[model samples]
Target: MRLLLFMLGRSIKPAVLITVFVSVVSCVMLTFCEKGGYVFDKEYDSVFTSLEADTAYDKVSEMADNTRAQNDDLAKRAGDYIAAHTKPGSTPPVLPDGLAGQAVRAAQKGGDSSSAGQSELYEFMGSSLKDGKESEQLIGDKLSGYKRNARRGVTDEYSLALSAVLTRDYEQVLDNQQLADKLYDTRAANTYLEYIENDMLFFVLIFLICFSSFSSERQSRRLSAFAITKAGAGRFIFCRIISAGLVCGVCAVIYCLLQFCVMCLSGGAGCLDMPLQYLKGYALSSYAMSFGGLCIAAVVLRVLLAEVLCAAMLLLSFLSKRNITAGLICLAPTAVMIGLSKSDNSTAQFVTCKFSFLFGGEGYVRVFSTPYPVVWLYVLICAFAAGALFITLIAQGQRREY
Candidate 1:
């Protein structure tokens, strides 16, 4: 226990420094970074606020109705103009003032001959007419879906308002049963999601702390004295692993808290009660957790994965003759996983990417005809891997020739 405490004390400084550095970088980037047309900006906040105040669903329903009506009216006008102007053997009428007329003129200018101009003009008219009709129909369908959900007591004005803005391009979510039951302005949730999506920083921190755990002692000749007896070597290995685990666990907790504080300061703390599924990219998740619960789960999972990484690094450090060799060996898999994170293959992503579980998705796996969350499956796998690494380290320690 004394040795474990001493080892932990030795790691405290680097662990604290890494945590502080990561916190500063995260804060600076999140605060100063331009969002570049991100949908959930101040405008979205204001719209959500207005919807919350209205509460009666009248404003949003009216907006949907108005948009549908305007699209239909414009489509009718464009169709009428196209019909009258395209009549055979008739003089071209003066173009009317408006977007439809401007579009016709633009199409006319693109053609090289009268027939070509007429053909281009007709094509533009037909496409515009089709687009307008399609848009109006889409709006109608969305509005009707909202009304149906409202009747089923599944959605409220807030859901309708959010659907109008965020789900405009996702026609399929119009009738999603998991649509948020109340107003949850996703600005806060989105901010939190962005923070947890990538864990490369944590990976690097784990590597720095554990890569020298055994190799440094070995280089200093202290490991030779410790490994002179099997019992002594086993005890020493156990202490080192425990100490590394404790340090990594502390670092994970500190980092999670710091980021959570940042999230709170950025106006997301109150949104922790929001449904997890309400967040972007999680619309299909059936987990019955609030955003806060999801954050807690992510923190726990990160700590577990960090411990697994610590064990692997410790094992490599034990085997390597030099600290630098262990560091390079530890980094190889980390780099591969980082590269694989950008891949489009879902299976590869689920296996190699931390974001696959950190940012929850449709993460269910069937076992014995029963469904279980994939995160738990990952936990089990990590447990087995850690055990195997520990066994390998102990066996190697027992056999090492001083």
Candidate 2:
């Protein structure tokens, strides 16, 4: 038991220090970052109109009024586009330049059209037209249904926030054509998630960090020495997994705490009562989620995913002798996971399988209304990860030589 404890402690020392450094760096970035605003000055504009000009104020007001009118026109066009293309089995809508050209242009401010098959503008509009309206209507209907069934003031908190947001003229928001299009698209609670989505990059970094962790000793040929210790091969393998799991789990917790601290410091921390949201260009309307639901789901998901990745990397380390091969195998899900994150067509959250890491982020992002199912999914995935670790332990135990 002492030997096992010593090995575990030795393995996690470096990881703990690394976590502290990473958390400090992340908190520093948050301390300097603007709430829901860009950290870089890439969009800085130097040219300015002189306010001394006689007609400057008039010109600006006129421009604002004209822009407002134009947006109202665009909103009509968008509505027409949605009505026309959303038929059963019909192709998704693509608004003509004459229709939503302005909205598309606004959403794609940072996107380049010439470089890709489909520009970010196209993707944003398509997602907005497809999911934005559906989300809005879903919340509205749910709120109305609950209102009819429940006594006064006994309504769900999400329903109240959702109804309040929906009470605002959604058409007006779409018409104004904000750069992010967040005006009409997201639930109030989703604002917090949207602000922190960039934080997911850190999660990827964590995965990469853990990927090399198990392979390190094996590459150094020191793993064999430890396997023949007084604890025997089985204990050695299990202890190694325990060490990795502890490291990964602790890292996940630290990352989450640091992230939330960043959110709080950036003035976006108080979104618990807000509803969950879907991304169009930004947060969607109506599809409110309970903030509590989203928080629990996201935290649990991160921990489960970190542990699973650590275990998988351990198995891959033994299955393939080449570090590059094992690392690639461990990273096989990155692209697919990203794609699933952006897509709403993923299979049910409860259907986690071998590609559980390829599972959608929405399962947590939208967990306000889907708490139980997604929590169960996380539990199931963790179980599978444990099973995989046990199998790895047994397989490694059978081998007498490195």
Candidate 3:
């Protein structure tokens, strides 16, 4: 315990605090200032310039266009093909590359002429929800860890939770033109799509911070000296993992609180339980959420995820001789996750989304709609990753002399 606290104390040096503070401030300011110069000011103008208004209008129009693009007849057909290909009593088919599109186009011969991408997007989401349940079907047999508990949002038997998800997404995306414009008028001051844009830099910054966990210690050769202090390798690795994770988690909390303070100041923290629309099909969900609820949830999950990832970084340090080598190994994946969240910024810049969408808030509607705190499958992946890395590093550490 003393060793753990000591490690954490070392992790929270002034350098860490200063870097985190500066990074958080820079990101929040960059994002918040772009949203028409802060809405909380009493002297704030209640109008958009001609350019701003035109930008908002074009954004919505482009959103619908993008949705239409992603959800062409081919995508709709592909979704159906994927669904049809599934076997009820067997594992879902893991197809070869482009199989979905191949099957979809092969099956369709030009049926519906005037279709919207929202419909196809809904189909894809429904397929995903079904796929998740099917994947969860092995809980009792092969997968003991994934029991069906309603409190955890898991059910042993199949459930059509996808219907509710589809409905919500549809409602939010099909907003009347008037409401769509109102959502982006820069005066409404809601935690809708535009609000999330202000926090993108903050999230990317968190990803960067997490990527560096243990790099400095490894570079400074402290690990070798620390290993000599009367500790078994297993005990040392375990303590270091915990210590690093805890330190990162605490730092993440500090970052989150800073972002939230900025949110409150800029009027981004207004509604705790208001309906939200991502307004873009590239987003994870088209549904609504308690705007504030989503932010809080995003912050908590993203922060904890950073900790787990940091532990993974520590494990990498044990394997790689160079800190830059270890750091790059971690940074590559963070970059990919961030990239997956990207849409054409030119079109999406005014809409205020893509960040949280990439970070796991896309289907958050259904996650919150349920009474129990169900662990998302992606989260389960993180848990598995954290556990695997910690164990692997511990085993490796055990073979070395302290």
Candidate 4:
């Protein structure tokens, strides 16, 4: 324990100033440099005052039902117009002026008449409701048809079972109860999501702290000397890895708290006690949590992933003879992942994207016949990978040679 404390002390010393500087800079940038200034103070205040006068849930439900009905009417009219005017394999005629015409024009831009028409219909629906008008009633009515379509034409047992599980999950989310009394403000959550999505500084700070975890000792020939000590190389390496992880964890906590403080100061924290589903982009989520709970979960998951990254960095530091080598080895794949995340490849995006798990309810994966939360799956995979990396570090450290 003393050795661990000593190692932690050393690891934290150089990181203190860097972490503080980075956290402050990040907060400043998030406040001022973001597209819309921080806290969205004006918008938040306006919405809060409006919500205070009206029952927010009732307003949302009424608007959603109204908009959904309008959307269906527009879609049916557009379909009928296209079918009446165009023959098979012929170009669709210019639609007449109306809401249906607008929908048809929007769909024509995408080339594929059939799929694009449905996409445009939803796009129109989304735009109509984009201004802080969302509710379970709206989501339920919209997704009801989607659920039916998802279950259609599944002949194989595996596909049939998977579809059933997914449809059931969607049904549960649409029917889940949410806090009706709380008022939600999207400003703070939007700021938080935007900040985290572009948070390269966090990873950079972790890399700086852990990139020299063991390589510096090796480079200075202190590693062999430490191997001869009573603690031995294995114990020494373990202490170093643990200390790096702990320091990284502290940094993660500091970062999250700084963000939360910013949100509070901006008046966005009022909605923290509201249901997570009430947040923008999360109306379809199945997670049973409040906005505050989601924030806490995001922080916890981020710290876990940070520790996993710390361990991997330590392994590189342990194996590499120089700190620069360790850094390059760590950075190469990170750069690739970032690039892939920006590409149009769906599979690559799914693997490299952090947003899906960070902000819950984007989608789910099936495990056998059961539907599993993407956040849970991501955490489990990271936990296993961290264990494997730590085990490899220990085994390698136990070798006789430095």
Candidate 5:
């Protein structure tokens, strides 16, 4: 128990920290404008102007006039009725002793922060003042009109005008369009970046583990000692590989969960089920990266070289903006293997790449469709990695001298 606890203490702490950092960083990027609002600052304001510029202002102005008049009358009654009404042009209606306080309480509660509640009340007032049969017929007619308009792909201009009333500021139409565009597309871009980051987490984990584990051992001559031990080379190599890969996998899962949580919180449940294909691809890529990193580190034999190589790969990947390194590490070989082999247009062909590291690949099919050849290509890479690890183990076993 204590030994297990020690291992967990060593492993889970860094994993948790990495996951939290990824989540927080992602959330900040998502909430703020990154790379500027370049996409949104382009298209939507025109749509807003077309929908809302003219009719909205006139209706809101009319409503504002009516509301202002009502407020002014109420203020005048409160201020002038008791003091000036007794002697002036006309006497004001006297309120009952408790009526003013009741009205005050009603006003305070009635017009509370939510404007939706106030609008609902006005709607209720309008409904109540109408005849029941007429109201029912009106509702039926409106429903039919709504269906017809939906079929015709037409929008209600009055609703747009009413939106202006609710919004109050003419500029808000543009602001809302910007907000909607930002919320929809820019946020999606951030999520795409996040998916990339999350998919690349295995790579990050590999770098961290390779740096900390192998470099430390190499510096301490621990690897040299292990190479001379009874069965130590194989056991030590496999154990460290397993440990590092598992740690990376766990961290990837936590990061994924944190990212999904952020996505759900910010974007609502609509993003919950977006692009399953991309998610699958991401998972495939992530796992392949983790396992491939372990094999690469084991094969390289020099801890410092392994670290340098991994870092260089990552840096090059980011800088190149080409899909080559990403494809290599992301199990593109698997996609190749799946495609090059012959298959019927049957159930076997409809395999979904199940991976936890990256999101799914971006492909959709209604069964009988082969996943893209790219997917199989990544799988083949993973297979090659496994084969290389086996060869490395055999080579180490054949070496007589440490």
Candidate 6:
């Protein structure tokens, strides 16, 4: 226990203070989430806002109706041909790659003209809703729902633009839950983004952890003289990496718990009911970002370089509008296991909350898969373990110059 405190003490109090400050800030900002709805802000509201409008709805509906009428006219002609060509007991053409062949393949795949027809019907219904009856009712219902949940007013211009998504035409699906599900999906994505963009303190905590860990160690010569003793370079290095990683893990846990408490107080049970899967997702994300910092310290012999690189990597993960922190964490072990993979910016949309992996947030909707967390976390921990071995190897190889 004392040893653990000693290791944590090696990190300056400013780092601890930074973590606390971030936690407080995370709580304050996330409070606005209750009334804010899912939209990021005025600037990017278009990303999620539906694009249907009264004028455009009418036009689309009219166009769909006209197109369906044309298709109906054509279908009648085809029906006439079918009736005239068949004999009492004769089969039709078996030519491959023809319309009939295409029909047959589509049938095997459980899809065909029926599927196309249904899609066309949906499009037609949507268009008719814009141009036809109940247009005003449809617009009102959508706007009311958005306004009730949203923190701010959506502009009239954007609201009019997004009318299409809300105006559905299908008679069959008009009663179905498809629209509800779609709205939920959009909200889920927006909720995730909202948490990511607002968690500035999470980023600050990460930078502080990395910078302080290395700088403090350098000033104290804490890792010194492990060289002259029987403490193998491998064991000594592993200890330092583990020590640093554990500190990061503690800070991350505190950050999350504090945020969770704040979320509960401000938003009530609705906020706290964030599913278990997302909780696990948050844990994995914290480990990935934290471990990445630990590994950086090992490679760059100078603590300052290590600290700067850690800060830089955290920033880089956000550049592509997709999180790649897990992937970067995975590379930690690669440096020694098979040589570091050429670092490149490849964006991925993970099933679990990618933000949870990148920062400590409790606002995830659904858990997609656990394999990503398990696989990457193991790989990252291994990287830190390998970094420990490398340090040990350095200690053993270069004897004292006495």
Per TM-score, the best of the predicted structures is 4
Per residue, candidate 3 scores C-alpha lDDT tens digits across 1-402 of 987888678766853675476656664564545354432232222212222422433433454466466556556666676698898888876655675545444444332322342334333333322322222122123222222333467643323354344344444434422243322322222333344444455445544555555556556776667667788546676787777677667766776666566656555543333333322222333334444556666566656566565666666666666767876786655565455445556324212223344432334323444422122544565677777877877787777663
What does the lDDT read for residue 388 in candidate 4?
91
Q: Candidates' TM-scores? A: 0.67, 0.53, 0.52, 0.72, 0.37, 0.35
Q: By TM-score, rank the candidates, best first.
A: 4, 1, 2, 3, 5, 6
Question: RMSD of each candidate?
Answer: 11.7, 13.6, 17.8, 10.0, 19.9, 20.0
lDDT of 2 at 253: 83
Q: How well does candidate 6 score on lDDT at residue 226?
A: 50
User: Would you list the C-alpha lDDT of every candidate in the order shown?
Assistant: 0.62, 0.51, 0.49, 0.66, 0.39, 0.39
Q: Which should have the higher TM-score, number 1 or number 2?
A: 1
Error of 2 at 317 (Å): 1.5
Worst 10 residues of 5 by lDDT: 277-286
Model 4 C-alpha lDDT per residue in residues 185-270, reported as the tens digit of each score:
55566667657655677777677777877888898888899899988988887877778778889988888788777776765677
Off by over 4 Å in 6: 1-5, 9-14, 33-35, 38-193, 197-200, 219-237, 271-402
Residue-level lDDT tens digits of model 6 in 325-371:
43344234223212211222112222111333223321122224211
Judged by lDDT against the true structure, how good is candidate 5? 0.39
**lDDT: worst 10-residue window of model 3:** 131-140
> What lDDT tens digits, residue by residue, belong to model 1 across residues 1-402?
777788778778787787778766765665443242132354334444665422323444454455445445656777778777786888766547885554454345333322333333333222312321233244456556756776787654545454443334334333332354455545555656655665456667677677888888887888878777554776777777787778878887887777777676767776687655556556444355667888888788778777777788888888888878888898975676567655667665565535435344445565654545577787788778877887788788767644
TM-score of 4: 0.72
Deviation from native of the Cα of residue 185 in model 4, angstroms: 2.1
Deviating ranges (above 4 Å) for candidate 2: 20-140, 143-192, 195-200, 273-293, 322-325, 334-344, 348-374
Error of 5 at 396 (Å): 4.1
Clash numbers, per candidate:
0, 9, 3, 0, 35, 20
Model 5 misplacement above 4 A: 1-9, 33-190, 193-205, 227-231, 274-373, 386-402
Provide the lDDT at 195 for model 4.
70
